[model samples]
Target: MATSTEHLIDIDRYTGELIQGWERIKQSIFVILTTRLRTRLMRLWWGSKFNEMQDKPGNEEVLMSSMMAAISAINTYEPEFKVTRVVIEDMGPDGEITITVEGIDLVDEALRRLKTTI
Candidate 1:
C-alpha cells in the first residue's frame, strides 16, 4: 500500500498544477466579468474627481463607499485573487482610504484590465 506521504505528494502534485491552471482561469474569468468594471473603478478611485470629492466629508464617505462597492464586487467574484496588503494613506474628511492591493502580478493584471477600458 502507498504510504500516506506518497498519497499526499501525489495529491499535492496533481492539485498544484490544477490550482495553478485555475488561477489563470479565475483571472481571465474576472477580467471577462469585470473589465469595464475595473476601468470605471480606476476612474472613480484615481480620477481627478476623486480628489475633488475630498473637499467635503460627506462626499468622501460616498466616494469611499462607491469604491468599496467596486472592490467588494471583485472580491465576491474572484476569491482567489488574494489581496496580500492594503494601505490606508489618507482617511481624509471624506474618509477616503487609499487601498493598494498586494501581489504585483495581480495589480498588473488589474491594471491591464483597466487599461483596456480607459
Candidate 2:
C-alpha cells in the first residue's frame, strides 16, 4: 500500500510513472523474468534467460534449474528484492507459465509476495 514516488516504473506501459509498493516489485520481477539475457545494452548478464527453456522437455529438473538461475540472476539486476522463494507453475493445459515469488523489499524492509504469468 505504500505509494512512494521512488517505486519502479512500469515498463510495459507508456506512462512511465512510478508504480506502487507491491505492484512495483511485482512488475519488476515480471520484467526480469520476461527479459532475454544479453538483450539489454551494457548489461549482458541481466535477465532471466527463460528463452533457453523453450523447445526443451518441461521436466521438474529443467524447470527448477531455470528458476534457480533466474532467481539468482534477478538479484544481480534488482538488488532491491531479496527473493526467498520462487514457485514456477507450468500450466501446460492452459498454455501459460506462472511464477510466484516471495521476497523482502530491501528499500522498505517489508515482505512481499507476487505472482505473474509469462
Candidate 3:
C-alpha cells in the first residue's frame, strides 16, 4: 500500500481515508500547486517552490497568467498526471478562486476533471 504523501492519503482532518486512483493523483497535484516555494521542511526548509497565486492581484489577467505558468510547470517528469489544461476562475461576490484541472492519469490512462476552490 502507498504510504505518506506519495500515496495521496488525506493528511488533514485525520479521516484515515485514502484518495483513490485519479482523485488521489489530482489531490497530489493540488498540494504541489498550493505549497509555497521554499516552505516545505523536507528540503531543509529550502525547497524551490511555486507561488500559489493567492495574493490578491490588481487584475484578472495577472492572476491567470501566474497560475497558468506555475500549474503547467508541474507537468514536468511526474508520472501521476499529464495535465492537458488548467482554468482558473475568480468567483465573484464570495471571493473564492475556482481551479479546474484537466489531465490524464498516466497509470491508467483515464481522463479527469478536477475542480478545487480556494
Candidate 4:
C-alpha cells in the first residue's frame, strides 16, 4: 500500500502531528464537501454545490441533488477515495441534513466512512 501525508490544518490542536493515508483522505473529503464552490480564489473549481441546497425545501428532488453534488465533488477532488455509496438523510423539522459517504481508500485499500451534517 502507498501512503500520503498531509499537515493537519489545526496544527495547534494536533501539536503538529501529520495526518496520513486513510485519515488524510477522509479529512480531504470533508473539506471538499463543506466548502462552497467558487469561494476559493485560486482553486475556483474546487468544492461542492451541496451548500446551495440549504434553505430550500428538503424534498426528494433537493435531497437527490445534494447527494449528486457530494458525489461529484468527491469524485473530482479526491481521486484517491473511490466513492461507493452516498446516503443523505433529512433530520426532520429543523431542516438539517446528514450526509454519509462510504468509499474505498485507494492508498490503503480499506473501506472508510465519513458522516457530516449540513
Candidate 5:
C-alpha cells in the first residue's frame, strides 16, 4: 500500500488531527460529487455535472447521464481514485437522491466506497 501524508479538509473529530489515506480519498469523492461544474473559477473543470440532474425527472436516461458525468469528473480531476461503478438511487417525491461510488484506491490498491445524499 502506498502512503498518504495529505491533511484532511476537516480535522479528525475524536483525535483532532488530520486524516490521510482512504479517509482523504472519501473526502475528495464527497467534494467532487457535490460541487457543481464550472462553479470554481480556478478549477473550472474540477467538478461533476451530476448536481444538474437535481429537480429533473429521474428517468433512466437522466440517471445514466449523471453517472457518466460523475465518472468523467472523477477521472478527470482526481487520478488517485479509479472508479469501478456508480449507482444512483432516486428517492421518489422527496427530492432527495443517493449516490454510491465504488472504486479502487490507486494509492493503496484497495476497493473503496462512498455514499452521499444530495
Candidate 6:
C-alpha cells in the first residue's frame, strides 16, 4: 500500500502535467492580431499578460502575418464595413472553428458576400 506522502507526490506530479497540457490548449485558442487594431484589442483584452503570449504563438510572427492578410482582405473586399463588435464564438467542434461577428446589419451583408464568394 502506498503511504500518504507517496500519494501526495503522485498527485502533485499529475497536477503539474495537467497544468502544462492546459497551457498548450490556451496557446491554440488565441488569435494573433497583427495590425494596430489587434494591438489595441489585445491591450484591452489582456493588459500585462499580452507580452507573455506574444512570442509563444510561433513568435507571434507568422500569426501576425496571417492576421494582416485577413485585415487586408477586409479592407479590400468590404470597404463599407461599419463593424461595431466582433464576436468569435466557439461552436464546439473537433477541430473546426466558427467565427461569428455581430454588428450593424453587417452580418447580413457579410453572409450575402460569403454566399456569392463561396
Q: Residue 32 in model 5: shift from native, Å?
A: 0.8
**Candidate 3 — what's its lDDT?**
0.60
My TM-score estimates for the predictions, one after another, are: 0.28, 0.76, 0.67, 0.80, 0.80, 0.25
Residue-level lDDT tens digits of model 2 in 1-118? 2244355555435467756556666666777878888898997777877656655577887787778876786677775788888887664544467778888787687788887777
Pairs of residues clashing in candidate 3: 37-49
**Where's the lowest-lDDT run of ten residues in candidate 4?**
5-14
Clashes of each: 1, 0, 1, 0, 0, 0
What does candidate 3's lDDT look like per residue over 1-118, in tens digits?
A: 1223343334432465655666567656666666666676675343113344455563777666656654555575245777788777564445566767787776666688888775
The lDDT of each candidate is: 0.37, 0.71, 0.60, 0.77, 0.78, 0.29
Candidate order by lDDT, decreasing, is: 5, 4, 2, 3, 1, 6
lDDT of 6 at 97: 27
What TM-score does candidate 2 reach? Answer: 0.76
Q: Which stretches of candidate 1 lie over 4 Å from their true place?
A: 1-58, 84-100, 103-118
* lDDT tens readout by residue for model 5, 1-118: 2246443345554678887777767777778878997899998867888778887888888888989988987877676788999998654566677988998887767798888887
Q: Top lDDT: which candidate number?
A: 5
Q: Between prediction 1 and prediction 4, which has the larger TM-score? A: 4
lDDT (10s digit) by residue, model 4, range 8-87: 33222245676656667767887888789899999998899988887788788988898899898998888678888999
Worst 10 residues of 6 by lDDT: 1-10
Candidate 6, 1-118: lDDT as tens digits: 1122211111223354433222321221223222223245545432122223233334346444433443343433332333343332332334222343222223223321110000
lDDT of 2 at 22: 65
Candidate 6 Cα misplacement greater than 4 A, ranges = 1-72, 91-93, 105-118
Q: In model 4, what lDDT does residue 74 have?
A: 91
